[model samples]
Target: MLVKDMMHPAVCVTPRDTLATAVRKLAHEHIGCLPVCDGMRPVGMLTDRDIAIRATAQGRDSNEVTVREVMSVGALCCSTTDPVEKAAQLMHLSHLRRLIVLDRRAHVIGVISASDINGFLSEPRPFEVVFYKEVLDHLGHTHRSQLMRISMAHGTREEAVRAAILEFEETRRVNHWNALADGYDVVSVRSNS
Candidate 1:
């Protein structure tokens, strides 16, 4: 699918807008982010988290701080005609929950996030579904989270460790395992529908 096929037009703010304005939009829209734009062109992004960390935690006056002061600069954007896979890749690489979509004229058109991809995840094959879902989990959602842990009382040898790993993977798909160390080598097994 193309970005134009799935993206929704964004709610936005301007650089000159106060942080108070952005916070109000976030609450009113019940959304996490807003594209900071100048006319039709996007310049930065403001998120709910930014307000919490930059203004609230720092004890700054929201009405005095502009979006330009806390908004993240240089958003990642994909063309309207670009494939959905391209958007997924960019979001994954950038650790972003959503990406801005732009037209050929570099005008902000819409937004694409993992939630939008959920509707189009109608792949016929099981593996294809799993593939997209795994990417989406890293991109935004966390429907299933898998973790693995291994503990040894004796010597740590290569062949034995490999066998132990393989055994643990096949049987312990969710939640229980004796771990080697505290919070060491955790793995998120891909979820299936």
Candidate 2:
């Protein structure tokens, strides 16, 4: 699979945007990070964790501080045509959840996350199933030691809970016509994943 095949459209913010504004965008979009751009050029990245550690923990006011004050100095990017495996490896090395996707001209186009890759690798399932799996993967990695200590006690219970949770997610998808309306486009499940 190619990067473009898995990347979702990028939602961006400006350097001058207040942390409050950026946080709102993050929450509204249901994304963990955003590319901070100066006009059409990508400059850096802002993540929820960045805000928490650099601003909130420091007691800086979100409404007063700008994204420029807290965003990572530079954005990591991958070409749209690059292989998905390459992107995944880069993310693993960098300990990042997502990377900015750029066109040949270096224009930011989209963002790709581990969730996207995991969804691509697995057989198609309800969105909620894939989402929960990704969440478990992230938690397991993030708290590897803690989980290992408790794994024996919770292993069977965890599996049962996961199965029950996934079973509750609606598996049926609504079908629609192949043709698009004049000004509308549909992102198929393959690409949406």
Candidate 3:
């Protein structure tokens, strides 16, 4: 099956769009990601996690943060004519569930998710099932590992909990988004593995 045969019409965001607006759209749509578009072409991706990790965690005012500031740029895309399996392979490699589908003009026509692929099937193939599982597993592991470790000083017990949460947010920003990695505040920690 071709990507165009299964992809959903994309709901995209502009680079000038604010994080606050993006969050509202995400919640209202019950969707995980938004394509950051320049006109009809996708330029980046803003996942729900990106708002939490890259915006909320950064101590930046959500109203002031634009999608371009934290979006995962240079999104993976596929021609509308490409086979669905090819899109799945790209998703597996990128740990993504959705892919932007583009036309000959490099304009986004739609997006295809693993769910869309599944809907295309009455009985999914073994590899398709496995690929879907692997994508979920990878995403799960990534989120769990965020804010894994951080230290912050606090006076009261409640304050300590809040501080720790903020510290985790800061850590996730530095480690995942590299927001402040160049600053002197960064301290590298060795991984146990």
RMSD of each: 15.6, 17.4, 20.2
Off by over 4 Å in 3: 119-193
Following a full C-alpha superposition, what root-mean-square deviation does model 2 have from the true structure? 17.4
Structural similarity to truth (TM-score) of each candidate:
0.61, 0.61, 0.60
lDDT tens string, model 2, 1-193? 5799889999999999999999999999999999998876789999888999999999999999999999997878898986565677678889988899999989988999888897655554222212111123644553111100000112244453344232222121213211111111111233255
List residue ranges in candidate 1 displaced over 4 A: 118-122, 125-193
What's the lDDT for all of these models?
0.69, 0.68, 0.67
Better of 1 and 3 by lDDT: 1
Residues 129-187, candidate 3: write the lDDT tens digits: 00001123644552121313332222444444444444433424444323422221222
TM-score of 2: 0.61
Cα lDDT tens digits, model 1, 1-193, are: 5689898888899999999989898888888888899999999888888888988999999999999999989988888986565576568778988888899999988888877875555332212111111124556764532343332222334433543454353344434233421222422233465
Candidate 3: worst 10 consecutive residues by lDDT? 126-135
How many residue pairs collide in each prediction? 1, 0, 0
Alpha carbon lDDT at 32, candidate 2: 93
Q: Where does model 2 exceed 4 Å of error? A: 122-193
